[model samples]
Target: MANDRRMTTDRFFGGVGERLENLQALFKFVDTTEPDKAELQDWLESNTAAKSESTIKAYVGFQRSVGLLELEKDQYQTTPRGATFADTGDPELIFEALLENVDGFETILQTLDNEQTTTTAIQASLREAYPEYQLPQAVVGRHLEWLQAIDAIEKQQSADRYELTSFGKRLLQEKLDQKPTIDDLEIGSTYDRVELHEAYGGARYRGIAPSADYPYVFLFTGDSGTEHGYKDEFRGDTFIYTGEGRTGDMEMTGGNKAIRDHKEDSCELHLFENNDEAWSVTYLGQFECVDWFEEQLPDTDGDHRKAIRFKLEPVANEVEFTDPDLGAVDTDELYERATGAARTDDEATQQTTVETTRTIYSRSEAVREYALRVADGVCQGCGDEAPFLGNDGEPYFEVHHLYRRSDGGPDHPDNVIALCPNCHRRVHHGKDGDAFNQELISRAENVESDSGK
Candidate 1:
């Protein structure tokens, strides 16, 4: 929550360059101005880059909103944060105040978390989140400019896209108790850099994140990497992925070793295409490293080094569906296996196709099947029988995760519940999703607990 002062004040600002230099001019005006409320606008426009009185007023409001400027007896004054920045010449203090005091500052950062976005995308997101503000196009652009001005986000030189900076990531993690809000990751799916790190760790700045905690070694490659000649592309049936190492020789160590020996370690290889246009990556399906060879490549430091590039072939892991074979396993055995079982990804079983493979994990399968079986042709949420029969001639139910898969929630019996379509929508899209989810949570706990007995 913003302070009462910030909550009531207007945050929209206009006119002037959305750069740090413009802001510094304002601080100078404040230092030189006399304590006169009536002459403040004149002083601002004349002393600063703002040419219009309205822009000057807007700047004042913006500064006040961020705790940079204060109104003392109707005269313009600087706050402690403002005074400190003015004295020390540090822009971090200004950005800190913006993140801490502004209503939509942090929201904008989170919106950019997964990938870089256009000014238009940022505007659309702001409208969706804070429609009441109804900020104009220019106001929104100014806000983004402020973010870039403070180094929280960087504008791509070639395009209008804005990418989050390392400093911005650090601020989000350290200042705000923020993490990825992604609920689940469907195979053949796409995720942003931020969500990738949240799901498996080890993927933000590197080409290959070891992802030892998960069942796969995640490979990230994008058009950006092509700049350094660390290009990852496809050749016939093989997806060629270059080894990781910025400087010196690219050795078969760390993430490179992880990728080379994934098969020996019982780890799968998951390939994602990092989008050049946006900040997200698309899963191209799972791959198997059939071969690897050393190649001479120029490192970031401009040294010719030996790099290990891997030959990846599409993995066609087979998964057996249980719908046809339902009830073949005894209830006791089903409960035993399904209890606390987990999976590599969110999908309950692998998709049957040899291309663009999706996971239908056996463990997640157990979680889904156990929930559906225990429901006994009933809707878990409403205590009513399923709405209709599926193509398999059984009650139809969609499994809902009490905790999200992207948040590292397990695909175990305790974390999922089966619900009818109507009940499922109510849990996810209804007016009170959390409240409705709470109802299902209780029912799921009861269902899992009763089966244990």
Candidate 2:
């Protein structure tokens, strides 16, 4: 009876060992299959002895707690710890091994090959397989998270799908090549001219093509809008003005004779500012104004003879001249001084102070109240009250002189009327004051007649 009891104890220990082995095999399958919980349960029940579903579940939970498995999306996968164990066929030995050598990192490579998954998917799968693991989710998440942060694993937008990154594939290929001194070095060098040409196929090296020539010159002629019927001429390669006025018309014959002489020639007439206070000619293209030679007088009527006179206004930043010789030219400085002098003179002429002090009054409130009473608080222009409503719901209006004081208009209340600011300003400041006043009077008369009715 003593021997039989000892035999039973030994069998009990053997069964416990077998159960542990089965659990390890289950974890290996999860690492390899990366199956969801239900699929894993189905596989375990079919392959193993009659273990209860609850027992399998408890074992799964225990494996997760021990950091041997991971749970993700209701699925189970091998953790890095479990993967290491599977690769070495001994979890305790791998746990004790140092990770200094590249061979120690081979576990990750082997896991990748076994699972055919991205580092992220592998990590996430491990979390699902070991849902109750004491290891922080951050630790399990770090491998994939770091890879993704460094663009070593591709993350899907809204799916659990992941794939090896380009860098990861390159690393694996490099490992397979067995090349010593795998430096993972980037060649930090700029391309030479020939190398760039070869890489881009000499595309960018093609010189910029020349633009087509547009040689058309436009000549504009118009009457000077003066008593003299002489027309003014403006010539340019294009018909656009440079805001410097007509460049070609500053000639003696109003540019007409000069343009006629050089009708088919290409020339530039640069009329720079002369010393005179008005516009004067400088650098006359290739033409010169000839004096009217009285010695070569023709027997012609005065009206038949051509007389040319040109006038140009000094624009901003352009030169001005006061004499015909282009001497005494003034730049914009003369304009500034002249404008300043005029302003100073005007300021000096203004009244220093009125002899009698007049009391200033704002009749805005009175005008607003009176206008609202007269027009029933409506805009006289649009027949609406929207313009008059203040933030506190009071009608707004402005007081205006019936006749402007500038135009001998009285400032008395009798001359004033309650009108919307628009109508008020229009009556005093607009072009048609009489018309606006007439309309106001007509409206007042109509209101009075309605009151009587």
Candidate 3:
């Protein structure tokens, strides 16, 4: 029972009022992962008043004692209560915890009582009030240090005395009245102002979707009202080909422009839900634009028009969400990083260009060459000869995928076909594109190897 009473005594890191602020700092330091004592000390030196190892030790001990942290081996991690306080940023809850645990810290506050006083004055007052206890000036200074650390009291700009902050006064009043306040409700977040308008029904902004030429962090809002309604069918992590519309000659502007510029190594994509709440713009991590092609899409007037469709692949990282600052990273280096290759100093300085390195699979080149050799200067789709010869003195027909690599298609010879440029465009954008694909599937060799036929 005696030890229990001692445990019940409230103690702050620096002294009475400062522990919560210290707790806040500690939580911020270990936002999602545990760190060692040296790391904590380093963070304190950079972010807080405590600079020495001794001061950080005291602060960490105080936090551990108050159930804010759990030390395992050499690392410190946040307790569930610590996480809650960090997420909510509720000062009152922190204060309540302190009041229940710390012993004589409240006496210091009661004595100061919202007055503008110096540490010298506080010491004299404490001495006068409790002459029998014989509290030292250092103890009084320590308490004042804590109060100041927590911003319960601040030094006046014109005078050398300390005064209570508005937050300090509200805290004191709420404790006295035993009343509670609520947290601010979240509105919309994540989507930019223009995205918000497009997401809602204010106005339809053309060229908003991400494209190959200028890959953007496009939102795949899986909602019923969306133009393509792909969101309803989207499941897990996979590639998507966008519905087409809004075309230009050799260039797509607006959303189409963004997609047109998307390079597999350079573009970025994000998925969000169509929850229609201000705060519901959840970040679904970054994705890679693997491939794109033009497809026929119906315009507003229901007429078929050429539109650019994009294929996206996910970037797997240890962190749950990463909001990369695209401008800070060189576009060339960004692609290199995306493709899992090291960029030398010279390569990083060069202008942004599409890289032809292996990313999803290394055998893609071998498969393409094998399929081209099998075609032997003839377009398999149209039974026509190659339109031209290449520098290698071979037919220049392109290897087309029966299934997209982004959509779990194998990079094998059987799943690929050689096509003339005209037939390639016809299969991707013609009115009978689906029928043409079915025809290829029936005749294409070796495609059934992975399908358990």
In lDDT terms, which candidate is top? 1
* Off by more than 4 A, model 2: 1-14, 91-453
**Per-candidate TM-score against the hidden true structure:** 0.37, 0.19, 0.31
Predicted candidate 1 versus true structure: per-residue lDDT over 200-258, tens digit per residue: 44445567765422455678777678567595754323567998877777777767888
In the range 205-265, model 3's lDDT, one tens digit per residue, is 2223432112243544434323442212221123454543332322354444444454543
lDDT of 2 by residue, 1-453 (tens): 000000000010113225435545776787788999789888878877645777777646645654567888877888777776666565232222211111112234334542346545555444332222232434434334433433434556677555556665655455546423212211221123232222211112111100001111112122222222333322110111121112222223313333232225332122211212221212211121212211111112213232333222111212222333221223232332222223355543563442433232122222223334445566665576747476767677544444432233332333345556677668755898789877766765576588662
* Candidate of highest TM-score: 1
Q: lDDT per prediction?
A: 0.66, 0.38, 0.54
Off by over 4 Å in 1: 1-36, 49-55, 97-137, 140-324, 341-453
Q: Output candidate 1 Cα RMSD.
A: 19.1
Sort order, TM-score high to low: 1, 3, 2
Residue 294 in model 1: shift from native, Å? Answer: 50
User: Considering TM-score, which of the candidate structures 2 and 3 is the better prediction for this target?
Assistant: 3
